[model samples]
Target: MGVATQLVVALAIMCAVLLAVAFFLLPSRSNKRKGLIQIVVLGDLGRSPRMQYHALSIAKYGGHVDMIGYLESDPLPELKAHPNVNIIALPNSPRVLQTGSKLVFIVTAPLKVMLQAWSLWSVLAYKTEASEWMLIQNPPSIPTLLLAIIVCYFRKTKLVIDWHNFGYSILALKLGRNHPLVRFSKVYEQLLGKFATAHFAVTDAMGKVLRSDFAISSPVLSLHDRPAPLFVPLLPSERIAFLTQHELTAAEANEIIDGNTKLIVSSTSWTPDEDFSVLLKALCEYSTSAITDSPQLPELLVIITGKGPLKQHYINEIEALDAKQELEMVTIKTAWLSFEHYASLLGVADLGVSLHTSSSGVDLPMKVVDMFGAGIPVVGYSNFKAWSELVQENVNGKGFTDAEEMAGVLKSLFDPANNQLDVLREGALKESKRRWDSEWKPIAGRLFELTT
Candidate 1:
């Protein structure tokens, strides 16, 4: 054989050998088993704490998830995708049925949701060759729940109800306890308690309330609130940069250090019950007052970053306060931010504020967790026991009952001589880790087990 011909043959042989080795190392079609469990998540897929937490857990863990939910009218940031994840967007438009009979819902709503769910479930059921699991992340509409229950019963599938909040209690608070909706929710919850294979609550307090109040037979699991983990380590320089990115000038950054300016940040969907207007009035009052004996008061700046139904109302209140001239109350309509982006914003904030009135009970704001992760001190109304416990245990934040106390706490936090800022920062970081381990991980593990 000619030398060139022999060399060509050798090269070809080497190429074939490498290809064969690569093929053997690669995952085979048979090795890729269809996930053992199929989870159907029913909720509003818009940026909600419960939905985000469950979706992330499903992505990390192994499962084929069919997310059937309502998408926000506004565009949302793309969520991290997983191989097993399938998003089935629910109809955003209102459902209309032509019927004079009140009993129409008895036939219509369930039929619609079931038909929609069945379309996806049928495909997964045949392909996976496994009994599917249905997880209702939030309280489904009564008709929807009824349909799900009927489907589960027929399919012999296990049902898991994740009680994100005490909906029945909320209903009672909003509408009198004697209201039909409140009573109906109670019955609905009891029915779910009896039928569901498992019940997951966001906090131990929530779980205990379920077991005691609802007489639920299913084993109650505490799936505590776990904010998404911080992927990027935040350095001091990076924190300053984050502030600048949001439009804080170099002089303002120096003012933060020199204690010549104070920035109070409250980043949440502005709701009437949250009482942003009250906070605005307090800050306005504080800012206009002269500091005679005390050291120069920091130039108060309130940065509000979210929008909701109450956005216009808050805008009107801020304008009324004339916070634009004196307080620099800037409202950023950033309804859609990736978890990381939101955390970075919170991290640079000097103080985080969230207040709930007496009417708002047992509410734990997700922004509070973001603040904790950012090592930012939180000052808010302490109406809820859970909030009080977290703030007290962490020693990273302070809580109060009303606007006066809240204002007092903010004054103390921004005080230069206090030297307690470092202590709070250290405490917040420690508590963040403790919360991740004790609360977040176990809940995530439980969700993993359910999905797998």
Candidate 2:
């Protein structure tokens, strides 16, 4: 062969070998991950319901999640059991009761953030991978985001923020809206939100505000909370066992079951944001109107759940009301239930009432979502934009403004002859199923898209 021809053929052969090697290495590197993404969650972990849900979604989608959060009570078994998730509880995230007074918490807030940021920095420096993302929950807002911006900048990792509510709006709740701290929080949130690569809002309304008001140019996703799988009707035997376990007498069981007593359940965090006393006044009105001597009137039972600052005051009020014995047709009960027990209560209850008026008129209450999952009709107060999406008068449930109107709606729901409750319950079931099958998965899928 000629020297020129031999040289050209050898060069072509070398090119072919290089192309083959490149193709081989590409798929091998991509397939090595098996589509698994590594995510680290930093937030008010154990206490925040939405944050916990986010972690569960990541773990379920084959992601390796390092959840850096605090444990307020017992650890959630479902999250702990997931093989892909590791729960790294921090020292500062404790229950509200453990935090002493609101004033003390406010005074020491900066120091608390510094300590927590230092702890988080150590974890990210030693353990984080280049491809890993830091998903943070906001409102306690600036400190965490500032720390994330610093750490992620150094690590060359992306920061994703799941905005629940603005931390400044919460400050407005405690301090006045005009407070200098509140102003600072507002400016800081707007500025720091731009630092995130992606932002997820719990409601679409919040998303609009993020773009228009906060001017966050990052990719924004809306992922609302879905019903946990556990919220479902109890089997006949399971209902009987639950009653027996609670040590309910035969007559009490009959009152709940065969007696057709309308069981109304409500939950709250007992903060100033929620005016549970409005629910109390409505119950009073309900009991007063029951004196009409209608033989078909189903007895009423109100069950309130959760512990907070005003819990003792409300407990005292409820006890005094119970002692008065003027509520001939109504009975009251309250307890701080575990997740399993809470779901069971929702399953068996005839209806649920939500007294949430929104802390800042930005976020929707989660209690209503739990009720819808159990196929229980709810009476909710329409105080925010998101509630309008979840609640409809005489459709899925009823909404009201004041105690008197709320009382009237409650009576109409519990009225024996009317089929309103049944119709609303059916709507709730349909909405719940639709939310699970069609709505939630696609929105939640957005989180995975961020890693790509």
Candidate 2 C-alpha lDDT tens digits along 1-452:
55533543464445445434533342211112322333444444545666666667777666667777666654467987988777776666334324545465554454455456556655554444444577787766756677677666755566888787788987787767875567878998999889998988878889899999999888888877667676776677877666546632234666776747777889887877788888888887778888764446678877888777788888888888878875677777778777888888887778888888776576878888888888888898886777876777677888888999998887777778878888998888776664432344576555565232
| TM-score: model 1 vs. ground truth | 0.75
Q: 92 in model 2: Cα distance from truth in Å?
A: 3.2
Candidate 2 residue 24 Cα shift, in angstroms, is 42
Model 1 over residues 1-452: C-alpha lDDT tens digits?
65533543464445446434543453322222334333444444655655655655555565566655655632123443555556655544345632323345323433444444444333333333334566776544343454455546655667777766655665454456775546766787666566877778766677777787778877888766645566223688887786666553344666654556665667765544577766765675555442434444566656676656577776776666563564442222223355556667677667777765533254467677767777777777777756764576327877777666665666666666786666777777665664443454465456546332
Note each model's CA RMSD in angstroms. 17.1, 15.0
* Per-candidate TM-score against the hidden true structure: 0.75, 0.83
Which number leads on TM-score?
2
Which sections of candidate 2 miss by over 4 Å?
A: 1-44, 93-106, 126-131, 235-237, 247-251, 292-296, 326-328, 435-440, 449-452
lDDT of each: 0.57, 0.70
